[model samples]
Target: MNSVVRETPARRELPLPDGAISYLEWGAGEPGKAPLHFAHANGFNGFTYRRILSGLSDQFHVRAWDARGHGETTLTADPARHRNWYVYRDDLIAMAEDFKQATGKKIILAGHSMGGTASVMAAAARPDLVRGIALFDPVMIPTAARIVMLMSQLLRRRGNPLADGAEKRRAVFADRQTMVDRYEGRGAFRTWPRGFLEDYVEGGTKPREDGQIELSCAPAWEAANFRAQGHNITTAARNLHVPFALVRAERGSTCRPPFPMLLKRRDPAAHVMQVPGSTHFLPMEFPDVVAKEMRGFAARLEREGR
Candidate 1:
């Protein structure tokens, strides 16, 4: 017997206020299948997680959206107006509502880094529409770090190294190949698996009027995202009533010490695991592991009739 083949992800757009949200959808349009929405990290687009999402397409109706100020999303992304990550939280909530309305079913939420944090915030805000959430190394800073960041913000000081690095990132590249060459085996991308960097380069750049490819996510916007960390993720994590699973990186994790312990304390039912030898980019380094955790979490939620 010949095995059936699934279709590749379809790029689509959902109309929102002032603009549209671009997303990629995978899996057959099979009814009764739980819908899963994946959000990408800061400075990354939906297609960056294509491999992971595509793998889950067979099990769940998978969709991944490029967050505001990233990829093909047409939402307004004014750096000056970006005060905190609440904007991203609101956007994810909107997307979840849309998905719920369209499918008439509660959706599962998952994300990486910034996306993961936004997923938690959105799930907490609208648990009615979200069945559960699985996060990979969401940016839950330690208490002392948060205090220091708050102080820096109060003093109007620019002490965020991530934001500083983002501000200094090269916006324009000669071509995609140049970007691949520059990014391959370097810095944050050093641990990325094969084809992941290429996928990022393909989806993270756009053709400029000058015939050059520029970063879809502008440096200022990325820097703004990095600096806009005022959102209270602790409260969000605490507010979660549905199934929650967090896969944190062992090395250079943004979900720092005590935060994970705090999460476990707040909700002993919340699943938190640290991958051995994983970096901040856990999804890229261990896509299968992350996907397995997500699949298992969603399956448990389903079994529990969540």
Candidate 2:
């Protein structure tokens, strides 16, 4: 897949209440074909998944968007305020609605990390807009940890460790190439292919007047995402009525499958599988596997005709 050159996607933007949401579309599907809509991980934008989405575009029309405060999407008013993960869910719901109204068909939701979590909430809230969901290691805290997470919010802690760490991130770089060089095989980006890393640096950064580049998504906003995790997945999972497929990473994943066992129990058709030798960054490490899982999900939905 890495050897093949992919086509550049057309950029588009949508109007929101406070600002506009930006996205990329890979293919054009006919009237009856269900388009696939993808939400990206926290701190990362839709362009980061260009390789994976573009690969699947041959069979499925693909659209991936940047979350609020990420990529080219304008920063929300008062970026510091994020009570919970529901804001992202709401944003996704709006995007899904807009997409459906424009295309005249429901869409399949596919996402990783925060994107996956928000997808679940969107599907639950507006089942009419979503045909099915394919989640890749969405962040789902266990019952015990969820209680503590909510308690910390109630307690009003002094500083958010994640937010603080994000504030300390180096956002300015000499150039996009410099950023790519630094992340090519290091830390969280160790498993990413060189082309994917290049795509991330090129699409996720904007040139500054000083002849340097800075991250489009503010570090503070990324930190805020880490700090906010109060979405009630238990309810969302139970409420989801459409075909659902989840792929979790085997090692150090934030999403634990059993947390939403009720979905499996309620609908025996729902599928959940943990990918061995994968971590929180499974999509980046194994794009083909992620694509395969999503394809299988679409096939299941087609066979079930739900």
Model 1 global lDDT (CA atoms, 0 to 1): 0.86
Error of 2 at 277 (Å): 1.0
The predictions' CA RMSDs to the true structure, in order, are 2.8, 2.0
Name the runs in model 1 displaced over 4 angstroms. 1-6, 156-158
Residue-by-residue lDDT tens digits, candidate 1, 113-229:
999999989988998989988889999886567778878976977678898899999999989999999999998899886588988998899998888899999999999998886
Residue clash pairs of candidate 2: none
lDDT of each: 0.86, 0.83
Q: Give TM-scores for every candidate, taking all chains together and pairing residue i with residue i.
A: 0.94, 0.93
For candidate 2, write residues 1-306 as lDDT tens digits: 432436677898888888999999877654455689999888888988988888787777788998888898873834567768888888899889888887887889999999999998999999999999998988877667777866876698656666777878889999988899988888678888888888888778998999999999878778878777667887888788888888888898878756657667756877888878888888988888888888898899888775
